[model samples]
Target chain A: MPYVTVKMLPGRTVEQKRALIEKVTDAVSETTNAPKENITVFIEEMDATHYGQAGVMHADKK
Target chain B: MPYVTVKMLPGRTVEQKRALIEKVTDAVSETTNAPKENITVFIEEMDATHYGQAGVMHADKK
Candidate 1:
C-alpha cells in the first residue's frame, strides 16, 4: 500500500488536514492509476526546535 | 518537527514531487509559524496488492 507521510508545522485544523489527505490521495491515485483504498496518508506536526534544514536548525532559522 | 507522510500512487516525476515537498513545506511553515528545517516529509509508494480501503483490498478494487 502507498503510505504517504506529510510533515510540516502545526496549527492546522482537522478539516484542513482531512481535505489535504483526500485531495492528495485522489491526485496520486489518478496519476498512478492506483486504487484509492490502498492509499494511506499521515500528517505530522512538529515544533521549530525539532527540524533542521539548509545547515540551520528550524529554531534558529526562524 | 512535523513528520508528514504522503502515500500515493507512483510514476510521478521527481520534479513534481520535489515541487510538492517545497510547496507543502512552505504552506505548513507559514500557516503554523513553525521553522522550515524542522519539518520532515516522507513519501511512500505501495502496490495495489499491498493496500486496502473501505473493506476492499486495492488489488481487488482495481
Candidate 2:
C-alpha cells in the first residue's frame, strides 16, 4: 500500500483538486500495480513562507 | 537527503509548527545520521474531510 502526497502552493480550486486526486490515483495504480481503491492521495498546500530553496525562502523571492 | 512529512489535523499555532519542524528534523538527523541542514521537513495540515479511516471519512465520525 503506497500513499501518494502532492505538495504544492495554495490556490487551486476544489475542482482542480478533485481532478488531481483522480489522476494521481490512476498514475500510481498503473505504475505500482496497486488497486485504485487501495490508493490514498494527500494534498499538501504550503504558504510561500513555509518553503525555501537554496537557503532562501520562497516568500523572499522577487 | 532525507525528506520528512508530518500530516495532521489543522489547529497548531505557528510556534508549535516551528517546534515540530525543529524536533522532527533533529529526530531524522539523529536516526539517519543526516546533517540537520540536509534534512527537509514538511508540515501538512489537512481538513478532516480529506482524511478517512476504515472506509469512513473522519468528518463523518461522531
lDDT of 1 at B10: 65
* TM-score for the B chain of model 2: 0.90
TM match of model 1 to true structure: 0.54
lDDT of 1: 0.67
Clashing pairs in 2: none
Candidate 2 regions off by >4 Å? Answer: A1-45, A48-62
User: Would you list the C-alpha lDDT of every candidate in the order shown?
Assistant: 0.67, 0.77
| Candidate 1 residue A20 C-alpha distance from true site, Å | 0.8
What's the CA error at residue B8 for candidate 2, in Å? 1.1
Best candidate per lDDT, number? 2
* Model 2 residue B14 lDDT score: 65
Please state the error at residue B9 of candidate 1 in Å.
9.0
Q: Pick the candidate with the highest TM-score.
A: 2
